[model samples]
Target: MSIERIEKRQGATLVAPALLWTLVFFVLPFLAMALMSLSHLEGRSVVSGPDLRNYAKIFTEPSLLKGIAVSLEITALVTVISVALAWPLAWIIATRIPVRWRRLALLLAVLPFWTSYVVRSYSWALVLGEKGVVMNALVGLGMLSEPVQIMATRSATVIGFVHFFVMLLTLTIYSNLIQLSPNYARAAEDLGASRWQVIRLVILPLTLPGVVTGAFLTFVLCIGDYITPQILGGNNELTLPQLIMLQLGRRGDYPMASALSLVLMLIVTLAYLACARWLKMERV
Candidate 1:
């Protein structure tokens, strides 16, 4: 009845919708999936259970285990490569480009986001094909004696992921870079530091928050992505998401799929924790 109590009630009322939405949509469904993961498929029938067979199989079975490895490898490679490429690109745009053209440059950098994700993956498949542009150019330039196979391989998946994530990473790094004071760099230069030393020691270290944030996003997205790896990388290797789809589509194994999904979530959670810890350390 008091003003403070009334204001507290109003705050709760304002926050209720989002809290309810999360509880209903995310929490309930996650609980259902976790419960379903404990069940197992028995002779083509899902036996309701609170068992650990599916999780056991995931870690024990070599083929199933390989999917997790492949996903991790591809995700790590994509994150590292994107960060490597994006930093320089973001630096150039943030520092070198004219101030008037900066907005246009950012717009151009994110152009790939406008295209459909599936279409972009398929387009990469075409580009990496035997008779595709890359192959033709390489063959014409005598870079290779023949057109090599790139499509339907892990390399193709990494390439497709890197292409999209580079732009994403660029945006994050650029945002951080633009916020930095020019005086920081000028002070470092006045100390007789070389350009490379200024960047390597001063600028790069300051952007750790942005780099880690972008890399964490890249890891989550690249690991869980089904369409890109399916279309571009094919079944030569399977990521966790691709394997989850296979269980549902081909084998009708909901329990196993649910289990795999939990494993994926677990991996993402660990990544998030690691990032958080490091960021806290940075702040300290």
Candidate 2:
């Protein structure tokens, strides 16, 4: 009857659509998958289960456990490399580049984004192959005695992931860096801080939120990606996504795939929580 009650009702009405969408699309499917994960395959037939056998197998089986480790290693390596490369690039664009050309510089930096993801991955596959341009150049320049096995390895996967994620990290870091006033650096210099010290102590500390956000995104995407690792890293080492695909495509083991999917989601959730907490602590 009153204006306050009317406003509350209007707010609830506005929120309802989004809540419904999430429930229908995300929540319902997740619940179904969770239920399926509890069940498992019995020699090409699915057996209903409240059993933990699949998850137990995931932990106990060496190959399955190795997939988790491989995913973590590659994701971590890509995140670290991306952040390291992106920060300096974002800094140069935000600080050193003229205002008129900053947009153009950013445009050039993210040009790879215009290409399809599968195309980029495959393109890298060609570039990293033993007889690829890189190896040919290296050998021609006498840098290597022969072409090496970079194509079907973890290095290739990391290179692909870092190439993609560096652009994303640059954008996030640049947004943060541009918002920072020049006065912060000037103030530190006025206090007799060196350029390196100003950046390490002041600029880097302030950009923690953006760095963590970018790193978290990189971790989630890299760990879950199947294309690059399958094409570049090969079947020599299975990442979690590769393992999930194997379960689905080969074994038709829906339960095992569901369980692996849940595990991947859990890892992403944990990363989100850690980043969220770190950002909260930074604010405090």
**Could you tell me every candidate's TM-score relative to the true structure?**
0.96, 0.95
Error of 2 at 167 (Å): 0.5
The per-prediction CA RMSD against the true structure, in angstroms, equals 1.3, 1.6
Regions of candidate 2 where Cα sits further than 4 Å from its true position: 1-18
Local error of candidate 2 at 46, Å? 0.9
TM-score of 2: 0.95
lDDT of 2 by residue, 158-181 (tens): 999999999999999999999999
The whole-model C-alpha lDDT of candidate 2 against the native structure comes to: 0.95
Error of 1 at 183 (Å): 0.7
Q: Please, what are the lDDT tens digits per residue for candidate 1 over residues 19-42?
A: 999999999999999999999999
